[model samples]
Every structure is written in C-alpha cells, then in structure tokens.
Target: MGSSEFQSPRVIKAAGLPYFTPANNGGAALNPEDPSTPTLFRPLTIRDVTLKNRIMVAPMCTYSTNPDPSSPAIGALNDFHIAHLGHLASKGVGLVIIEATAVQPNGRISPNDSGLWQEGTDSEQFKGLQRVVNFIHSQGAKAGIQLGHAGRKASAVAPWLSWEGKKGSIRADESVGGWPSNVVGPAGGEEQKWAPGNVKYWAPRELSTSEVEEIVQAFARSAKLAVQAGVDVIEIHGAHGYLVHQFLSPVTNHRTDKYGGSFKNRIRIVQEITATIRAVIPDGTPLFLRISATEWLEGNPVAEKTGSWTMDSSTELAKLLPEFGVDFLDVSSGGNHRDQKVEPHGNYQIDLAGQLRKVIQQAGQKTLVGAVGLITEAEAAGQIVQGADEAVATEELLAGQEPKADAVLLARQFLREPEWVLTAARKLNVPISLPVQFARGLL
Candidate 1:
C-alpha cells in the first residue's frame, strides 16, 4: 500500500476510533483554568512523529513468537504479538514501542523473542509486524520498535519456563525447542556466574572484530526492515545489559581492543550502530537509544570496588548521542549486573533520567530524554511531563536543581493496565479520543 493509503478516511476511521479528535488537529485551545488539561495529555513531537500524549509504552519482552527449531527464521511475530500490541494501540496511547526484537538469531533473549533480521515485507512475519504498525497508526498512536541483541544474556530459557526448576534462576535449555549455544559478548574466556540462585553461568565467547562489524550491520539491516514494516520510530536497545550495553559497561567489557577499555572505546560499538542505523532509516524518523543510566552497582560497599557502570559515564555518553543522530534517550537503570542494588521506590530511575537530560541540555543538543521505572500514578505522570513537583524531586536527586525529562516511558504499569493511558486521561479530566464503542461507557 502507498503511504497515502494510510491516510484514507476508511483507514483513519478503522485505526482511530470515532469520538476521538486527532491530538495534533488544531482543536479548541485548552483552558488554563481547567484542571483537566494535564501536562500528560500534551503532544510531543520528535522529528516527524508527534505523540498525542506524554505516555509511551516502554519495550517489555513478552517472549511470544513463532520458534522454528530448524530455521533461523524463527522469532517471527505470531497472533500473540498482534493481539497484544493491537490491544494496547487501541487504548489511545500516544506511542507504543514494541518489545526487544533481536537483530539476529543468536541475539534473541530466548528462543521465542521476536526478530526482524530475516523477515521482509514479503514474509508473513513482516506482514504481522506491519499489521501491528497499522493498528497502532489507526489508533493515532505513533509506533516504535526496539532493536536489540541480548549478548551474553541470550540463549537462556524463557522466564516462565526458567521457574520450572529454579527460582529466579535462568537456566540454559538444551532441548530441541531451546536456543542455540551461540551466545557472544565483549569478554571471552571469562566465565561469569549467575546469582539469585548461585546457578553456574557459562560465559559467552567474545565477539571478534569482524563479528562485531557484522553485528552493527545487522542492526542497520534490522532497522531498515523495521522502517519498511511501517515503524515510525526505532529504539536501539542499549540498556538492560543487552549486546550494546555490554559494550558500554566497563564491568562486562574488558577487551583490550578499540571497542573496550576507555569510555570512548566502550561506547564505540553503540555509536557506530547508531550512526549506521541513522544512515539507513529515512530522515525525520525518530531514533531512540535506551541506556542503563546507571548500573546501580556504584557507591554500594559491595559494588564500589567493582568499577561498574555509573551515572557519570552515562552522562558523558548522553552528551555524544546527539552527535550520532539520536533524537531521544530512554533512560533506564540496572540489568548490567546481577548483584546490582535496587531501591524499591516509585520513580526510582527518574533521577538518572533527569541527570542525563541535564547533561544533554547542557551540551546544547536537541536530544530528548525519557524517564522510566515505577512511574504508575496519573498525577505523578502528569507532573513528570509538566516538569513540575515530581520533576523537581528527580532533578533535586540528581543535581539539587534543574528540570526533568521531556517524556516518560511506562512498562509494567502498561502491562497491568493496557488502557492506562485512557484511564489517566479520565483521571486527569483531560479530553481524550476514545473508541466510539466505549464513549458511552466512559459517561
């Protein structure tokens, strides 16, 4: 279908339910005196795609895909992905970023993780992904897909199946339906053990220089395919101890080559991939890079000596991301190491996002920062977007002053409430477009 076809009245009606005005439409001006005009409902424009609201569905792995034991073409989207993502799209979300999709076969987090490397528009998998993007566009929500390689974290059984034998322990499944033993990372010959249950963990072989280059190309190729699949945004999964994060973090990257050791070297891989993908995708297509703002291993007495990834390094990286053409930074925390400490507080990683945002702004770059982690309440979500009290708290924690991120990404909360965006709109009393079928129900 042509690009103009997506704008047809029928498509628009099917995609965006009636009773909802396009948030970008020059509608009536919101009254300042109206408490319903919450900041969360304000539109956000990154490049050519403008989000109808500040709320974005963060990429959360579902491990639901078609896995072929004989084919590398496994990891194609099945009915689960379409129904799962399609449902979220119809809920009036501003943006919906699909979960971590592997760029290559071995890059998958499990045997069932979605992949786009081998799928094209002609393939069934590509069609499924395109169907998802169509559904999202129909709902007037910007669609995004996160491209990632799990690195050393790959080749593990799905989390649900992992609990069959051990609690919180991810064991390798050598069964016919399991992943192949081809996990690779920055460090080779050094075996890292898993905690939680003290399970023996075999280390991944270090990626050779040639292999590294191929991986970068793989990311570019996957991004190109994603764009062809109708994705409006491309998020590089550089966070949560993924392949790119492995290269960024000092704890995992101990290579003597140009891809490791110093800060510049550690970030080289991600920078290259970002640049490559930026070149491959169409101009104005927003590019987002998710980063583990802090590994959360620093400062702790048990972790202080490990010389782990820290906010300082992340700040430095955030400053250079714009140079590589990154439009947004999705700031997240931890997942680089098993022993990392996490405080069970709401908006736990907002401080890190605030810090990264400050650094990016101070560098005089246009790159937007997105805060995520435990942000569940509507009032708090509004405050973060408004850069008000809630934003002040995150800023104060980071630099004792300054504003917060430009946007916020919500994960588990969206899983808990697929209609959270609609719910938030109602709670904030903001005028939001809803499905015509549910319009009376809201009344």
Candidate 2:
C-alpha cells in the first residue's frame, strides 16, 4: 500500500483512460499516484457517515434462528451468524447489510427468520443485533440491517430444509417444526402457491386498514431500535415481492382503500414508513430503500396481462423518496409475481438503476443510486463504482444513459467468497487494507 505501487505512468495512463477522479475527493491528478484512492477504493459519504469504500455486502437471508412463541422469533445471533458475517466484514468490505429481518412476528418469511419486533433495550433480539453491529465496526466495515415483512410469502421452511426434501412438503407444520400460526398480505384473494421441489406455499390472510397501520408503526419502531443498536445504515426491504412491494404493485394490491389504488395511494404506506423512521433516527444514519424497480410482468407479452409495477413507476417513486428522507435507492427487480419474466444475465438490473439515477439527477435531488446483479468481475465492479465501462460495444450501447451506479452491492459473490473484495483489489491492481492476521496468507 505505497504510492510507488501506482506511480508508474503506464498504470496511471491505463487507469485514467476509463475513470476520472471526482471533484469532491480531489481534482483529477495522476502525477503522484495514490494507491489507496482507486475509483473502487474511494470512500463514499452518505448523510453524516462515510464508508471506507463502495463495496457493500448485500443482505442475503440465512434461515437460521430459534423463534419465540409469543413474539417474532428471537433471532439471537449465535456463533454461526457471528462467524458468517464477522468473517466477511474482516475481509475489507466497506459495508455489510444484514439479512431481511422482520419488523413484526407475522412478517417473517420463515419461522426462523431474524426479527427486531420485540420491545425493551435489553431484549435478546436487541442485544444480539448490537453484538453484530459492534463486531462489524471492529472489523473496519459499517453495519446495516434490512427491515422487511414477508407478507403473503411467510411460514415456509428454509431453502436448505426444502432442498433436502426432508418431509416432501413445503408447509412447516407444528408437529415437524415451529411454524408460525398465520401469514397475512395486502388483499384477500386465492392464495398464490408455489413449491419448488418439495416446498409448500401457504396463502395469507388479507390485512385490514388498521392492521396495515399497525405494521407501518412496527417498521418505524424497528428503525428506532436499529439506530439504538448502532447500525450505520437502515435499508427498507421493499423489494422481492415482500409486504411493501405487495402494496406497491397493482397486480397484487386489489384494495380500494387509501393504501391502494392510484400511484400515490399505493406508495402511501412506504412513504409514511420512511417519513416516520426519518423523524426518529439521527440525521447521520443513511436510509436506503430496496425496490424491485419492476414487476417484470407489465411489458412482457407472454407474461400475465396485469397492470403491474413498472420501471416508470419505480422512477416516479424514486423521485419522491428523497423528499421522504431516503438517501439511497438500491435498485433490483422481478420478485413480485411467479409469472414475471427476467433475463438472467450479468448486470441485468443495472439498466433499471441507471434509469432511476437519471431521473433523480434530473429532478435535482442528491439521492444516490446503487445497483446489484451479476456484477462478479473485478473490471465490472470497478466500472460500476467509477461510472465508466471499458468494453467498447457495451459502452457505446450505454452512451446516453446516466453514469453507472454510485455503489454496487454484491450478494452471491460475497457468499461464495467472503474475501472477494480483496481478490478484486488485487485483480484491479489497487492496494487495499488486509487484516494483519491474514497478511501471511495473502503473501
């Protein structure tokens, strides 16, 4: 990690060709190279907090928990969770967002999903999460948590359990395990069921207006607790067909009440939740909203012919989010319906993020945008952080698009290689801080 490592004119010329240093950090100067200040390695400041780098470990669910009968399962962090997340933080990630944690008991995707719904500062859930936050900070990475409600997609067995075909059933029965008593959603219709392999799907009871209000309050309360627990970022899990997404998409929300119908009404609940959480949390804590960007059903000819959530709608919502105090938009897509079609390619959803970023910029908002998809290559990830891609053909294709995402969030890649960031730094010829204990291994 010396300036000499990047001082070679050849290396400076090569790096300067694709990426330009932003005026915020320093004027574009390649004379005496700074090895620690590569585009991907540069710090990102949101609100009052600054990430050491742009690489973020996206929240991925690990259905390992023991639920309480009276409250949301007490998702106390055991040795397993600590080891799993702590190792990643120590590997040089700038930020690590924990999995989708429920705001209420019934909001969990599975009986074993993590939760922060319980009251009291000394609650087991609070203490457990605080320990995680402290550990992540100790490892030189910021900690974040995604607060979510599964809505109609609740009470299922873990993916691993289902894969094992243990009982050849999708439902988690009380006799077999501690299955939650009930699951609820936006509208009362025929329950949509899908059991890949032996997994079972259960229909959810429709939530009433009062119940929806209660859930909104639950989210706000959870945000307050997350702040108290010392998390640096709080992401609202509004993506992947979860409770908030259910209300956002017209395909699922058949409600005629204030929480549904029309664009403004559909986005009402999330708006209120954002505003409420903003009011409680400190101004320094960055607020993130993860949205599906599109339901992937509206424009597809073969998909179900329903009025669904679209990119245009997401852009509209992105415009309003900054007004509601959201600091970043984590753009992802296609989890609202079973019939929705998605092309599984590298950077598949990056276009959606680009679209929203342009809209937000044009609206003169300071909100940042993040993209997450199959960004597995060091070059690709660097391009995202630098807002420039080197591939001539792809670059031409994106000529008029807004600059690439401000940050890139990685999920599966981190799962596969917790030290992916370190590997990426090496591949990009960028110097990064390696844990002293692991320095020998790198050598």
Candidate 3:
C-alpha cells in the first residue's frame, strides 16, 4: 500500500467528542455543543487491525435461546442475538467483543453459554455466529470473541434470574432463587457450591503438564476458529476466577508441582498459551488477555495476603506479555476467590488500570491497556486513559452510566437490550445510525 492510496481522516478539523485522544494527528478543536472533542472517539489500531473508537463492548453473557431456555444453547442465529448485537454496531462502537463462549462442553460456565464445543466446522451454530460477525463488520465494527473455561465457576443460572453465587454458598437447586435447573459445577452428584464452584474447589486430577499443554493447544485452535468465523480480535479469559484465574491465584491452584506453588509456575501456562495463540493467529490481528489483576482474596492461602497477581503483578504481566504480542490488558479485578474483597463503586478498577499502565510504560513496553468495572460517565472512563483511548465495560456501564467504556463489553445488558446503544445515543444526544429494523420505535 502506498501513502497516496491511504484513506482520508474519518473526522474533520472539528472537535472530536469524548476525551480519549487519537494516536496520530492533532485532535480536532473542541465544540461545546457537541462535546465531541478529538479525543475519546479517535481511531486505534492494535497490531494490524484498526478500531474506530477506544470504546469496546466487553464480553458479556447472554443466555438466550429459541425452543427452550433450559437446554444447552446450540449457538443459533435467533432474532434476539441479532437485535442485541445489531443495535450496538449501528450505534457505532469501534469494536465489539463477543461474550465468553466455552471451548469445551465441560468447560462451560453453564449449559446455556454459547460454545463451539461441537465438531462441526461449518455447522448452524457456527454459521449463526458468523452471521453476527458479518453484521458487526457490515456496520464497520470489528468483531472479537473471548475464549474461556468456567472451571469451578462452571454451571449456574443465567444472571437474569435471581441467582446469587459466592464462596461457600451453593444453592441446592434453582427452586428457591438457586441457579437454573441445568446449571451444574465441577462437583456433581451433590449440592454445587453457589458462591464459587461448590465442594473443595480442589485440583481435579489437576491438569497434568500434558493436559495443560492440550489446553494451550485448545486456546490456539479456538483463536484460529474465531478468525475463521470472521472475528477481528481474540481474547483469552484469565479473569473472574475462571480457568486462567484459578492458575493465577494460590487458593484455587494448590498443586505442589511445577504447575503450582510458585507465581512463575502459575503464570507459566498463560505465558505459553498466549504465545501459542499468537503463533497460530495471523500476525497483526489484535489479541487481548483479560486478567484478575489482583486476587483481592483476603486469605488466599496460595498467594497468601501478600503475593503476586497483585496490581503490581498485573503490570508485570502486561509488560511481559508484549513479547508474545499482546495488544492490550483488559485489567479487571477479583474472581480468584468466591469472597474477593470487592470495593464496589463506579470506576473502582480505574486505579488498578492506571497503575498497571504506568508499570508497563516504565518497563519500556508499548502495549496498550484497557480498564473495566464500574465506569459510569463516558468522560471519566476516558479520563483514566489520560485521554489516550481504549476502555472496556463490565456489567454496570451497560445498565447505567454515560457511554463510558471505550468498548462497552456487556453481558446481561447486551442480552436484555442489544440495541441499548440506540438508547445510549438518544439519551446522550450523540448522533448515530441505528438499523432500519429498529428505527420505527426510536424514530
């Protein structure tokens, strides 16, 4: 590609809205009426892919299905999934990451969680996912998928119903606000732990080094599959006390061997896994890792009260990850334990993101980082980036808040209202082009 063939800038000299800044070119002048400063809405390119805005949709869970809700959702192209994703794309998010889809049947957080566990290379569910990917692309938004394993967190009622899961508390069934009937965990044939995975949360035959190697291969294969399905980015789930999170903390991963007992060993699998995934995926495609920066687990026996996987450890991970070609760190906290100390409030994770950013910068690494968790106002989310762009969402930003997350990755919010972005633009008075199908009501 020659310089002459390059496309013109997407925005004019007029002020860019939001606060996140563009990497190149002076941002457009400010406009009080628009508040569309040249900052927050800037384009960002990770690796070889480019994003239209810093905001990205966080990987959210949407346990929707046709026929019945109790069954294992064979990823179908139902109207529900379309309307949900279509609205976000039309709203003009630069990138939208699909929710965490289980890599294997046993790895699912619940039966209804979307997955590619089947053997079909081009089956209906796979095709449906592709259609969603195509729709996102048609709307000029890059589609990404999060690869995950629920581990002990496997099996639970969808968030929509009144299901509360914490450590040591496992509801016997979905009868009394328990997890849905099908939601099961690692410990079966008994009452599953509601809070975290019930039972000892013990090492299941613990992934042998060979099995660990197989898991790594699975991640790489999944990344390849996501690309084949037209996903623009691939994210590994290392947060929320899922499979990767279990390895990060001493509590969940209690093996006396090389795979555990030390921070380096615990992080070893992820390090190798990322490298493996990157090697398989086309170079330049964006690759991200979502991490439980700090276990925040008070007495996590393994990592102890003071151990790695701390905010500082997260920074180190980011810096180290760049070698394996990680484009960004989705810095989210907790999940290493059922009772992680959550200092809940809007934008609470900002401090950790900020600190991690500094640590990465000091390490002389150039990889960018994104923050999630409780970002309410769009401006505040941008502020944490110092207006540098790149922010993700958890559950809160989807329900309330100003379109704050750079890419608001939603779970239930997306499921409840995929076209929530439509509401967001209208409520905020920001301009956007919603799909014609959804236009009737909005207009």
How high is the CA lDDT of each candidate model?
0.76, 0.77, 0.61
Distance from true location, Cα of 279 in model 1, Å: 1.0
Tell me how candidate 2 scores on lDDT: 0.77
TM match of model 2 to true structure: 0.86
Per-model TM-score, in order, reads 0.87, 0.86, 0.74
Backbone clashes in model 1, listed as residue pairs:
15-138, 15-139, 16-138
Consecutive 10-residue window with the lowest summed lDDT within model 3 = 21-30
lDDT of 2 by residue, 1-443 (tens): 97566554222321211232111211111221353345566677899888877789899999887755654336665556778987888788888899999998778777778889888789888888887777777666889999999887777767777778666436665654444346778886454443333346676677899999999999989999988988999999999998999999887787898998898999998999998899889988999999999888866653354488888889889888878899989999988787787877876798788878878878988889898999888888877756322222234235753356888899999888878888887887765655645767975
Q: Evaluate residue 311 in candidate 2 and report its C-alpha lDDT on the 0 to 100 scale.
A: 86
* True lDDT of residue 120, candidate 3: 55
Error of 3 at 167 (Å): 13
Q: Candidate 1's residue-wise lDDT over 1-443, tens digit each? A: 77565464323435333333332211111452244465567667788888767778899898887666566447777668768876777776778899999998888888778888774578755776787787677666788999999888887767877677665546456663544357788986544423333243446788898899999999999999889988999999998888898888878888888898888898999889988998989988999999888888866654555477888888888878778899989988889787788885876788778777777777778788888988898878766667422323343335644446777788898789887877877677776656544556655
Local lDDT at 108 for model 2: 79
Instruction: Indicate which candidate wins on lDDT.
Output: 2
Better of 1 and 2 by lDDT: 2
- lDDT per residue (tens digit) for residues 292-347 in model 3: 87877555554464353577667657778877678888878886555566777766
